[model samples]
Target: MMEPIPGESKKRVRAKPATKREMSQFHTDEYVDFLHRITPENAHQFSKEQSKYNVGDDCPIFDGLFEYCSISAGGSMEGAARLSRDKCDIAVNWAGGLHHAKKAEASGFCYVNDIVLGILELLRYHQRVLYIDIDVHHGDGVEEAFYTTDRVMTASFHKYGEFFPGTGEVRDNGIGKGKGYAVNVPLRDGITDENYRSIFQPVMTRIIDFYQPGAIVLQCGADSLSGDRLGSFNLSMRGHAACVQFIKSFNLPLLLLGGGGYTVKSVSRTWAYETGLAAGVELRGGKLLLAVWPKLTIGHAQ
Candidate 1:
């Protein structure tokens, strides 16, 4: 029941994070390169579970695992700092929505929980934080980290029972004092943008209005965008960015993070386009120099 004191954004659309292999505390250098090598064609040669975690079958491990992963974490951390410093209405770290990364393992293509890390940085100052994830997959990593803390509220709207990682059941709400703080709105399969909007707005309004946290962190994954190889939904980037606009409309200290997003073409385009929306600038799209990017900092977090 706390009122939010909105912080300032930097008033600039900063570039993505920089990943340095030397700085990470979570992963080992050998495994980082291992993830990159066992991808796609050679992926089939790996153990089934290894292929599950590697890049070949679905989540392709790329050359920049060290670079991209570190940079993504950096962006999310910066977003948390931006909100605390209060440079603009919203601070976005789209590269930090890597929900699949575990405490010591990488699964579902994610190397780190940038969103959780960003929120943790924010928690250094504020007592209440609201995390809203609108990705196709459940925000398992973020939700798990905050599942026992009332200080943060994680609201994820993702596919129903038995998705990847095989967690996030509706009954999996918060535990101990964190009860009801972890709200899971498991969505149906193959939902369109309209369905997304309908369910998203009301639930978000209800939760944010009731909890009244000091800040909001949104995971607006572009995997919800149509034609994504891994995604089942049919949303356009324009439709997806509407979520960013909605959160910003609250005028709170917000960090717009990114996650999911498989199709290279649509994924990059969608997040970049949404970044324009969060900044309150008109995106000229291949014409103007002011085209902002969206929620890939964690997912694309580059």
Candidate 2:
């Protein structure tokens, strides 16, 4: 599980771990406390508390759980900060996009809703922020977090009813001031490049026209790619990167984040390809400077 390698010309910014106070921007104090207190020594007793926060099979309590959550959430926060400060036109956080964690609960292998926290950071500078989730499962937590806020518009494209944590429906648009802002494009199984584009392009165009957000956060979940262990879509590397390409065309302040992808090899390849796309590099005909199989190597290619 190596991260995507940035091009040699790109300046890499190291992310700092998110502190408890920083994470409290979106996560509840109690939930954050649980993540900090759970340890191998007290883990057996904590099992009884797991169900309260949806931390069982999907989100098991492992050692260094707090550190993992802090680092993952930290990357998204750093990306958002960079975008808000105009430090970078686009910031990529391959460790983030955990859209399934709620304000006080965990779900779908996500323990902290880093995307929400990241959006909050962007909101500090931008009047409006757009969150687009391309995970196979619905971005229920993120959609819910901004459901009543007009300043943040959330759009999720995912599999409908039969999927895990099923929630996204085309009819479930936002409420109150957020009405007409929450968009859902639920798809069937076996979606290919052409069909996905036919739907993605038009919907995204309409969203951009209507919302005109000052900043955009995209959750590029590799699980949607073909042969993903937990996904049903049939997208190839090119097909998956096409989504990133389309979004990058907007030329707005953008934050790219990683999401669901159980198949190790596919996830690494998809992210690496998309990273090249973000860096304005054409990796198609280039030779592999270093071979790591499931992971990518960081280096320059002629």
Q: Given candidate 2, what's the lDDT at residue 145?
A: 95
Measured on C-alpha atoms, candidate 2 has an lDDT of: 0.85
TM-score to true structure, per model: 0.77, 0.92
Count of clashing residue pairs in every prediction: 29, 0
In candidate 1 the C-alpha lDDT for residue 213 amounts to 91
Best by lDDT: 2
> Candidate 1 lDDT, tens digit per residue, 67-176?
66667777777767756866444665655788877654576878666776778778887889999988888888888878888999999888786667677778989999
Error of 1 at 295 (Å): 18
Q: List the residue pairs that clash in candidate 2.
A: none
Q: Candidate 2: TM-score?
A: 0.92
